[model samples]
Target: MLPPLSEKELDRLEDLLITYGNDYSVLNLAELNGFFTALASSPTTVMPEQWLPAVAGGKVPKFKKPAHEEAYTALMLRYASQVAEELGDDVDHFEPLFEESEGEEGSVIIMEEWCFGYMRGTQVAGWAELPPEQDQLLKAISLHGLEDNFELLDQMSEADIQACVPQVTEAARRLYRYHRLQD
Candidate 1:
């Protein structure tokens, strides 16, 4: 069991969020091969709880259509499930790139999700937040550095879904950054 992010590192993580605009950039790094331990143990170093209350909690109040936050949360959950299953119990042993998703809810009042998954994640709700009936949202999803032939959310067994979870998440996290932060 690694320790949580220290105050100093948390500050840097916060700064990183401000610089990039989205938190996923810092959260998805286990694939990088370095700093995995540091991130897993102390994800708050990069993902800062400060942002959670504003974004994840009902504080900021989305109050808009097309809830991007919820989409992001679901994507994170998919990643967590994959990481938990693939990495198994060893997940927490290292600095988990993504924490397990926990306590998620959607409603008309507050869009912000309580979000405890993905080590910790953010949530939101809004109109058209559904996964889409015709593969629209899934189409938007693309895991990084995946097999060219690999199709996301397509025909496969539970085992396939499980294996693709982390890859799917990496894609979402990357897309989230590119959509919001990356110019």
Candidate 2:
């Protein structure tokens, strides 16, 4: 699997998003990664148009310097492409953007953020109604986002969730594949 985003790269993108506006206040490096990854996985090829609003909170900022805009576009594409490549592989290996934290609570929080990002993805992609099968995954993401996985965490121990990380990653790949085959 390709190495995940480095701290420096994440910090740079995070700062750039912050500059855009408060709409991005809820987003972070991992959520951004999740959003772009979801978009890349979709059948649609429209990147900047959809991505700008999603990442920038529905408004693309006019950077004083053109390099900032160019750089952001390039990085976002690069990261999403990375996720697409990894998911496209035949192996059953996939990693979520969030790293494991110290305790179950930390991991729960990370899943909450990831789910929230994925939920945002469903909206920004304009996928109002997914197929029943794919919609199942979308619904799970929505439920997790709404509940923030706290309920799930309460029901299942962190180790249980941790053990299922591979499953979650695989589900993401399935979501990608499902959309990639859509009309």
Which 10-residue span in candidate 2 carries the lowest summed lDDT? 104-113
Over 4 Å off, model 2 = 1-7, 24-26, 62-65, 104-109, 147-167, 181-183
Error of 1 at 132 (Å): 13
RMSD of each: 15.9, 4.1
| Pairs that clash in candidate 2 | none
Q: Give the TM-score of candidate 1.
A: 0.24
What's each prediction's TM-score? Answer: 0.24, 0.73
Query: Which ten residues in a row are the worst by lDDT in model 1?
Result: 107-116
lDDT of 2 by residue, 48-115 (tens): 67667667776777787899988777666666767667666642466667644666355343565666
Runs of candidate 1 with Cα error greater than 4 angstroms are 1-56, 60-96, 99-156, 180-183
- List clashing residue pairs in candidate 1: 5-42, 40-95, 40-96, 99-118, 99-119, 100-117, 100-118, 101-117, 113-123
Clash count list over all predictions: 9, 0
